[model samples]
Target: MSPKNLSALNKTHKLLLNKLKDKRTRQIYNKFEKYLNINENFAVAVSGGPDSLALSFLAKIYSIKNLLNVKYFIIDHKLRNNSTLEAKNVQKQLKKFSINLNILKWNGIKPKKNIQSIARDKRYELLLNETKKFKIKNILLGHHLDDLFENFFIRILRGSGLNGLISLDKKTQNNNINIIRPLLNFEKKDLTYISKFIFGFFVEDPSNEDDKFKRVKIRSFLKKLETEGLDKKKFLLTINNLKFSNETIKFYTKKNLLENTYFSEKKKLIILKESFFHHSAEVIFRSFTDVIKIVGKKYYPVRGKKIDSIIQLINNKSYFKVTLGGCVIKKVNQTVIVSKE
Candidate 1:
């Protein structure tokens, strides 16, 4: 290797070491390392906030120590007037730490209503597109315990079922890539400390303070509840118990899918025999949800109410065909057939 490049590398290493001088920051980085013990290449979604900045620092340290490849990306949603500049500023700051960052833009039209929800989906879509292009199988996120709690309450407010309530797992499969959250057990304050001490700068998103958004409103409500003696430990325990129950239901769902349902070689068709509906309602509902998602190749499962309505149509003696969830369900003799619409 050239002497100049070697010297540059050594200098960057020294800077990273200096950032880790804080004992608490080092411990947090160690915990992050223990959680993300992967040797292959991966990418991190950096929003330039305290959470994502902390993630970038820890991921860089892990990559350097293990001789692995890790890329960083900032999504330029182009929502706000200064969004493009914000992305550039984040890129510039990380450059000082020797962490190279790429910017992905969201081009074209913007949503008028439900803006936050649509933007969130687009952000992941862009990030996952990067993963596919780079042939990487994992994408790390900056979600922490605070986000987890907020997601839980939001799902509840929307009348979510058990699956949706416990959907914020540490690791989940999205098509071929895995979405991992190593900091879900850590608090937001811990990450804030890392960003403040290491870089002394982080973006303060104005949307977080806007009460117009449901999430921001819930965050405020939770703060008040905490002051009113809400026990975080007990709340966490409740979520853990619910997760266990959800797992058991998932096991039965998988069993029913394997034992009672059959799929075509083309992977676009399914046949649920008459006996399929004989299982418990939950198992049958879950099994149907799986078939719809698989045949339709959709990222989300069909709504439960729609699935229940279809199940009713299937139970009828007369032949019936219905279309929903991008799939067509038809009854033939003693079996039900599902195919992409």
Candidate 2:
């Protein structure tokens, strides 16, 4: 490394450390420190929003303190005009702090309907691909408490079951990659403050305010409820209760799979004894979902409704074969067999 470049890097570090002397930044860092304990090199996805920009700073500081390397990436969906320019501007902003932000562009045709959902999936795909290229296992996201609350209400409106209701956790796996959301416990206000204090700006996505999106609608509805004196503390308590119940179901579901199912590694098949269906309905549903995902080799699990239908048919003692989520399932008298379709 050249001495000149090393000097600039030292300046960047000193600047960031100096910012931490600010009481507010220090407080946010302390709260952030309490949550993230990752010692391994990781990646952070930056969206140029307050939450993500704040995440870049906190994560950079974390990597610096732990002496671990971290990569920063942003997805350029190109859904709007001047998005490339915006991405470049964000890249420059991070470069000032010695954090190189890589932009991954979505090149295919964009969906007309379900734009947000497809964009989110593609964003993850792009980020995961970059992580794989770098041989990194974990990626940090900037979903804060507001997103968590909005997600719960959104899932409820979709008539999601127990597992779906609390699916978003601090840590989740997708496509064999670990997704870490370290800011779920922090509110948006704090993240916004950090972003402004550190970067002096953040890009506002217009889609956030557009009511056409379910998440936007839920965000608005939550504000209305807040006006009606809804207590976030109370709402958080409710979510915690639901999470506890979800954990219990997950526990039994694991037990059922361990005790009542056998997998043939060479044949890539799963055999489910009838006892697997004897657990509680939720446990059985969860167990079946896990098995189908494994046998199907799909990143996403099969639709819950379809999985429920298959389970119902198998429990009714029907001898039939059906295909779902790239998996073929059939019952043979006393056992259910699942294999790749």
RMSD (Å) per prediction: 2.2, 1.8
After superposition, the stretches of candidate 2 with alpha carbons farther than 4 Å from their true spots are: 264-267, 297-300
Clashing pairs in 1: none
lDDT (tens digit, per residue) of candidate 1 on 1-341: 79997899789978897767789988999899888778788999999999999999989888888888888999999999999999999999998887889999999999989999788878888888888998999899999988989999998998888888877888877777888998988889999998988889999999999999999999999999999999888888899899999899989888888888888957679999777888888888889988898887666677788998998888775588889888998998788999999
- CA lDDT of 18 in candidate 2? 90
The lDDT for every candidate, in the order shown, is 0.88, 0.90
Clashing pairs in 2: none
Per-model TM against the reference: 0.92, 0.94
User: Which tens-of-lDDT digit does each residue in 1-341 have in candidate 2?
Assistant: 89999999988988998989999999999889889887889999999999999999999898888889999999999999889999999999999999999999999788999898778878888888899999999999999888989999888887898777777799888767889999988989999999999999999999998988889989999999999999988888888899998888888898999999999989888999978888778888899999998898665677888988888899786588999988889888988999988
